[model samples]
Target: MNSNKDIWVFGDYRNYFQNRVTLQILARAVDLFSTTGSSVCAVVFGRDVDEYVAEYIAHGAQKVYVMDDPALNTYSIETYSWLMSHLVKLYKPETLLVGATRFGQEIAPRVAKKLKTGLTADCIDLELDEKGRLVQIAPSFGGNLIAKIITPVQRPQMATIRPGTFQELPHDYDAKGEVICLPVPEDLPKDAIRLITSERRPSEKQKIEDADIVICGGRGMGSKGKFKKLFELAELMNAEVGATRPVVYSEWASHDSLVGQAGKNIKPKILLSFGISGAIQHTSALMGADFIIAVNKNPNATMMKMADLAIVADANQMCLGIIKAIKEKIRT
Candidate 1:
């Protein structure tokens, strides 16, 4: 296997549904290494995976490796990681990308350990250096600075990228690729944990991470009623509402709306911050946005320093003003 010619992506699927996040990261990887002669390949593991190989090819995977088995119908940390390690050994790919999802968090470290390679987690960007090695860029020191990491001695350089950080390429249905089906190991672990049940709960009213525009309120909103006005503004803009960790911990908003290092990492096109002090944890998560507009009474807040535009005003008043402005614009 040529070290500089093949890149592998862990094609993540859930309950027979293909994860678009994998395609998004693959697109970015293609962009990062296009000048080099490297081709992208996706390794998928699931039951009835043949039906999904075309989807990965359409997203720029030159080849799709399928490891299908009934035991993989639901994710088992030990089973999936073991399978991935086997595939990596077989392919000897130079780079491996995985989505930074719950499953990814569980599986990537285990695979890295098995392969004895470095794994960079939650990477926002990727690039290639002069020597044709990958440069994984992720937040460091609580998002105060972006760190670029390289795997000099690792055989398969591995990184887990955050979803929404990469743009998915336009699909080409006419794209063609080879699908190799690998047999599951016959000597399966008899005591392997089997999935007992699966259920889907009603999703949250808003997924702030997926929202294109987010209006976040902080403790400075003063009261619950004022926070309600922030929701009104979000409604008028057809945006999702978010909150700083302090606001959520204070019961000003639900934990679902918390946006920070410990909360959901968002990469919205526009992030509007209200009444929240930009703590390192919160700022680290939102720094990936295209545009940041922060509103706070304090001029010296950390968030204000990093914002593209800053408004020095009370949180409630700003929310009300924005709601009125949006309503007026709609009427016109």
Candidate 2:
């Protein structure tokens, strides 16, 4: 494996229109592989993808491969997989990365099978070994251990990384990249999955998955009423609310708010955990936070041991006191 080859990122777009997580991953990939002399390229497919070429360049993509066609407006498993397979075959990149979103989960395995290559899913970290092979690290055996995966025989080492697992560099408007327009084949099988009209439901006020500041509660929250105070404090700070797995399973909060190995991984600027005994699984997922504050009745709890600020107190009263202090600061 030569270190001079390029690294490709699948710039997955949602319905050819909205949010894209690949740009963030691409930024991190650029930084990770920059010293190896491997430039980062992004592959985007859509109807009018020309409009997004500059966006990819701003995110540190050295080249943008655009596959524009009307048939690509909606996601078709067959079309997407075929297109990616073609790109992988054509470019022959040393490494390929895709976000482990729903769409990626659907397409990546299929592409890997088509290419007859190995893939590591839900990878948390990536690096290159002495042989210039990709070293993909992901949680394995229910988060009990970290596994380092490598594809020595595969032409392009493929991996699907979780969103929020990597930090993106600031967008540089003056960053430059080449845009290559690819042709989408006109003769393709009709999509088996039909897209009916889509509908949006009223979602929660704040989503823990995307929050910059998160306050989480756990089993030691005592009762549902006490757990609710976490949300009050979260609201006062205009932050998002989260919980450990036990809190969600016990019905103190919904499953979407759960954060841990079995739940969503969050990289907040500040993470505050109340009454939580941090299991290794939960702590591994949140150790990337810039700052962590843990409060528990037991001073020896795992969370208290690892937290920057550990407070031994009644969890409920401490949360209320913090909320009051925040409110007073806002008023003054």
lDDT of each: 0.81, 0.81
lDDT string for model 1 (159-190, tens) is 99997888788777688888888888775555
Candidate 2, residue 311: lDDT: 94
Task: Give the Cα error of residue 314 in candidate 1, in Å.
Answer: 53
Off by over 4 Å in 1: 1-4, 15-19, 187-191, 205-332
Candidate 1, run of 10 with poorest lDDT: 198-207
Q: Which pairs in model 2 have colliding backbones? A: none
Model 2 has how many clashing residue pairs? 0
Clashes of 1: 0
Residues 137-191, candidate 2, lDDT per residue (tens digit)?
9999999999999998876899999987876666676788988887886655578
Query: What does candidate 2 score on TM?
Result: 0.58
